[model samples]
Target: MLDRFTMPLTHRPLASMARYLSNRQVTPDQVTLVAFLVGMSALPLLAFEYYVLALMAILLNRLGDGLDGALARLSGQQSDAGGFIDIGLDFVFYAAVVLGFALANPGQNALAAAVLLFAFIGTGTSFLAFAIAAKARNVERPNFPQKAFYYLEGLTEGTETVIALVLFCLFPHYFPWLAGLFAAGCLITAATRLWGGYWTLR
Candidate 1:
């Protein structure tokens, strides 16, 4: 959902970072590993109620996430294995982040946290289903890969949700409100993706 707004800024920086890392003999797989490790560490940070540190860790992880693909393109090392690892690790990281938040404020907002987690499952499954069907159909359209590169059209994506979660962490007083908002967005995103898949696979 929010990836497109960042593209204008991230594109050049990512390209430059990829070029630099590629020249330094760094592998995209290594970058992916490092990013996943950093993201995992955020779990403990959340356990400690270190909201600021968790936010920073998540941002850093996202930075690495963005760079991996660019690094792959620059290094000419794109592979199915790399993509699988990237996507798989991403889901784990996302779930961890949400769990962290839920644990952090469990006493006061268990219901909201559970709802958010449920929405996460629904949204993730919907997006994955659409992606699988679309790929199986081999429906190639111009700039379609850009959806993976930088998701802009959907109501929500990793980037936006991370930002929203971070904001909610910063403002815990509004956590339930944010959860409700995100839930609505998730429904919209699912519907949009279903429509897209229907049209693409028809």
Candidate 2:
């Protein structure tokens, strides 16, 4: 939901960083790979109850995510392959974080984590399904021209997801409540997207 608003604020900084990395011979794929590795590390960190360190890993992952896109655009190296890898890894990272919280306290967090993951499936499937159809029909996403996939707006987006993760890290004891709340939001997003996308495509 806040992604569009935040995109402008982040564009200049990410572009500058991208230019610096481009000059240093760093590739977008390299950044994505490194970022995924760092992001995946959060699972073990969280399992061991190292919330702060896990939070750092999560933030760096998001940084790498934005940087990779900036670097792709800066170097004119953007490709479907790069986009595929980036988005694929993103879902895995999100799942891992939730699993980490569950592991932190299975008796309490497990059910919440499960519900959240289920909600994620709804959001992820609806988002991708709409993108696929939109692309097939050449539907333009004017709001997010830089996106490789057709972008859809909803109550829960990347911004909201990250905020939820950050809150989970900051208040580990509140994982159940936080995850449940966020899951509800995600479900609402999924439902709206499904309805809107269907009518738009129909």
Candidate 3:
């Protein structure tokens, strides 16, 4: 949703950092791996109910996520393999954080977490499935030309998800409500993506 607007604003700063890292001979894949590790660390923090620390990890994880792509472009080292690994690990990191919240208070959070994870499945599959078909048809991604795979815009995009996660950490007592609301948004995103993909392909 907000991705298109936020991306442009973020790109310059990220590119500057990317240029610095590129000069240091850092690989995009390394940045991706570090992002995953930092994101994964948030899982345990969440599980232990360390909301502030987990929030910091989440922010750093997102920072790494953005910088890696910039670094890839700066070094001219972007590849399908790098994008594949980056997105794959990102999904795992997302799931782990949800699980961490569920573990923190199973009696209150489990059901909501489960529902949210299911919604994630819907969004994730729809996005990837569209990407595959878009690739086969040679669809152009003017909005996200830097992506190695076809980029599908959605109602619950990266920006929205991050906002929801931040809310979860800040208002831990409201996790169930926030997760439910976000899950609904994710489902809407999935349905819209499915419809858009079908019409676009047809």
Candidate 4:
């Protein structure tokens, strides 16, 4: 939701770092893989009830996530394959974090975590499906033209998700309520995307 606004502010600094890394011959794919590893590390930390450590991992993961794209663009190595792996692994990472919460305290968090994951499916599918159709129709995404695939705007986008995850870590006991609220937002995002996609394609 806040991605568009944040992208401009973030892009310059990330690109600057990317330039330095590119000069060192670091590939965006390498950054992406490392980011995934770091992000997934939060899962174990969460399971062990290490909230502060988990928060740090989560922040680093998101930083790597943003940096990879900047590195790709700066190095002129952007490709469909890079985008594919980035998005796919991102979903996996998101799921893992939620699973971590559930594992941390299944008695309290399981149901909420499950519902959140289900909502993620809704948002992910609708977003990807719209992107595919938009591409077929030669539709442009002015707000996210650098993306390898079309970016469908949503109420629960990356920025919002990050905020929710941070909140989850800050107040582990409130995971159920936070996950539930974010899940509802995801559903709303899915519904709006679905409606917009239908009309645009028609």
lDDT of each: 0.76, 0.95, 0.94, 0.95
**lDDT value, candidate 2, whole model:** 0.95
**Candidate 1 on 1-202: residue-level lDDT in tens?**
6665665577789999999988889999999999999988888887778878888888888899889988887777887688778978988888787677777778765677777778777777777676666566665645336334222257887667877868876876677788778877877887777777667667
For every model shown, the clashing-pair count is: 0, 0, 0, 0
Per-candidate RMSD vs. true structure? Answer: 2.2, 0.6, 0.7, 0.7
Q: After superposition, how far is residue 136 of candidate 1 from its true place, in Å?
A: 2.0
Write the number of the candidate with greater lDDT, choosing between 1 and 4: 4
- Per-residue error for 119 in candidate 2, Å, reads 0.4
Q: What is the Cα-based lDDT of residue 32 in candidate 4?
A: 98
Can you write out model 4's per-residue Cα lDDT over 162-201, one digit (the tens) per residue? 9999999999999999999999999999999999899989
Distance from true location, Cα of 24 in model 3, Å: 0.8
Cα TM-score of candidate 2: 0.99
Q: Write the per-residue lDDT of candidate 3 for residues 35-148, one digit (tens) a residue.
A: 999999999999999999999999999999999999999999999899899899988989999999999999999999999999999999999999889888999999999888
- Ranked by TM-score from best down, the candidates are 2, 3, 4, 1
What tens digits encode model 2's per-residue C-alpha lDDT throughout 42-110? 999999999999999999999999999999999999998998899999999999999999998899899
